[model samples]
Target: MASDMLLQHLDYLLALAAERHFGRAAARCHVSQPTLSVAIRRLEKDLGIVIVQRGHRFEGFTEEGRRVVTWAQRIIAERDDMLADLERMRGRLTVTARLGAIPTAVPASPFISGEFLRRNPAASVRIEALSSREIARQLADFEIDAGLTYLDDEAPPGTRSVVLYREQYVLVAPAANHLMNAPEVAWSDAAGLELCVLMTTMRNRRILDANMAAEGVQYRPVVEAASVDALYAHLSHSGRATIASTAWLPQLGVPAGFAARPMVQHGPRPVIGLVVPDRAPASIVAAALAEVADDVDLEAHIAAAWDAAGDRRG
Candidate 1:
């Protein structure tokens, strides 16, 4: 019974860690702030250490608090794993898996989710558009079950990736824009155009910046947004152009009076893929998602789109 009480308190601690505010964490846990505070204090007394720093408000976690949070995560994960294993054995693995994807990969999510659901009829998916760095951090913290993001040169520890498609860029501009009719646009040429781009924090923006720098092209963007949808919204109202992956164009639908031209003078194509944590005993849902990812023919679809876009230019 004492162990059960400790487990309950651990849940409250993890919620506090995530929310970083006592009131918010209490709300998340469906308890009053004072109740949550008492639970945490009881946990500290049981553990013989202080976990959270107190002040007028929630200051932060102590060093010991951080370590306890890590252990709490592992303990909770193990409990879920046991439950999942039991459900799998009973042939009733019903779990909602959370997938974190970079904003640029949002267009591909429907296909991925559709296929995964088709294979695992009992399982549902929740996809969130996150930055690449956030995806990595979430994966490390077990906040997300899987991630769809660029397969960077260095994979994060405890994670494995499988390439799904090669991401190629294109320039999107209004039909009246001079470069819209061009078969291919060079990085240097794009640098001269008034542009709206992803914020510098995004990996896609960094890649675009590096490609332009390689060609000795330097220019400032007229607008910056965190998501591709915001970029599109800005482009819809102005004559300014934006860079986006070729594979995402079909989903974005060339807006009325807008055209997309393949970017020819860029650096190497970046590979975007599904990344899952490599737990010793993977969750049944993660295993199912990986199996579905292996069967998805994303590359073929991307290639077909690329060829069709080129044919349109001819």
Candidate 2:
């Protein structure tokens, strides 16, 4: 009974760490602030350490609190894994998996999700578009179950990655635009065009910037957005163009009056993949996701898109 109570207290601490506000944390835990406060105080007393640095408002956690938070996350994750393993052993696996992905990888997610659902009909899934760095952070925090992002990017320590596909680049432009008739456009040529691109903070944008720089192309985006949808919306309304993964076009369809063409002379195609924490006895959902990922022929989808882009260009 005491052990179970301690687990509940750890839940409160995790909520506080995530929300950074006592009121919000209590709300998340569905308990009164005072209840959460007392539980935390009790936990601190039992642990013999000052966890939170409290004041008139919720101050940050002490160093000990941060360490405790890490332990709490590990313990909670292990608890979940144990439950999942039991369910799997009973041949009744139920799970709600969260997946974080980069904007460019969003198109491929539906296929992956569909496959996962087919395999685990009892499972539910949520996919969020996040930058690579954000995905790495969320994975470390155990806020997300897995991530689909570039494999070469800096990931948190103890991250296990499996390559999915090499992203193929395409230029998305208005159909009437002169560049659309070309079978392929060089990065330097595309750079001269008025562009609508993702914000610099996103890894996709950084990759584009680096590619353009390598090609000695001087470029400035006319519009900058944080989401792929926003960039597409801008492209639809304006004559400006943007670089996007070839996989995006099939899922989103080239907007009416828009054309997608393969980008030639583009530098290396970055390998994107599924990443998860490298923990022993991985969570059931994570293990299933990885198994499904292995069977996903991402390159085949990209190849089909390549053909579609060529057809659109012609």
Candidate 3:
């Protein structure tokens, strides 16, 4: 019986239910009132039930009509689901991806991901926080679709990467700390001072250690923190200096007594890059995301953020 009815006309019934009036319903359906009414009547006849109870004005639907409305909703939902499934099966799949990055790398994502979505509306994206090593491992394992991390001199094998930004360590200390008065502080200049830093497990911490060792400087933190928040909290009140990426300073919200200054080191700047494993061809979504990353304004974005922070400090 259902096979005999025009499936295209089910829209008219939905429109009628929404408008509850013949003129508006037909107008919404983009058909003449008589055309829509005739279609609904035809549907009722095919189903062998009274779908709508007519009156001087428009009255409500009969019990069977209400049931038909419920059925229409289920049918529409199922139809859309099937269409999405079919698209995936046909290699036009809509992919959902998770990406992780260090706190500093977070800003680059919106610009890149925004343009990606504009180009590929069918793709879905998610962003999360992860350390450089974690980013590398996740990409290698295919657990995350992509990652942004410091691209050490040795690039990971079986992966492709595009250098996104370079990072230099900086000193963030309370203004009361004498080092702030200097235009630039050398790694050795921090030797005698108390320090707070993320634990040794983080790549950032390792870089800090290398810089200190290169300068033959040694210091210990009176307090330890796992995250940027804790690092800054200790920085704000501990009267000690913390070393971190200059990229992270903008979001740290340094209090009145704190200021960040770049470190003077002869070592190479750490290059942060967007990485994807090269083992397989990128899906349409991942390809679109990679294209977006290629077009990002890394220098300008970082310069602007730093400039804005400088303005706030002034």
- Which candidate has the top score in TM-score? 2
- Residue 287 lDDT in model 3? 50
Error of 3 at 142 (Å): 1.5
Model 1: lDDT equals 0.83
Please state every model's RMSD to the true fold in angstroms: 1.9, 1.7, 14.8
Q: lDDT tens digits, residues 1-314, model 3?
A: 56645565677887888789999999998889999999999889888999999988679899999998777754543444455456656756466656777655664667667776665577677988777777776655445667777778545566778777788676777766667777778888876678877777766777778888888877676766656667676665567877766556545545566777768876788888877767433433445556667887666677666676663332
Tens-place lDDT digits, model 1, residues 1-314: 36869888989998999999999999999999999999999999888899999999999999999999999988877777788788878877677889998889988877788898776678788999988889988888878888888897644567888788888888888777778677788889998888989889888898999989888889899999988888888887678888888767656756666777878755568989889999888866777777878888988876666666553332
Question: Candidates' TM-scores?
Answer: 0.93, 0.95, 0.63
lDDT of each: 0.83, 0.85, 0.71
Candidate 2 ranges with C-alpha deviation above 4 Å:
none
Task: Estimate the lDDT of model 3.
Answer: 0.71
Q: Which digits, one per residue and each the tens of the lDDT, describe model 2 over residues 74-147?
A: 88888888888888898777878899999888888987889999887887899999999999898888888899
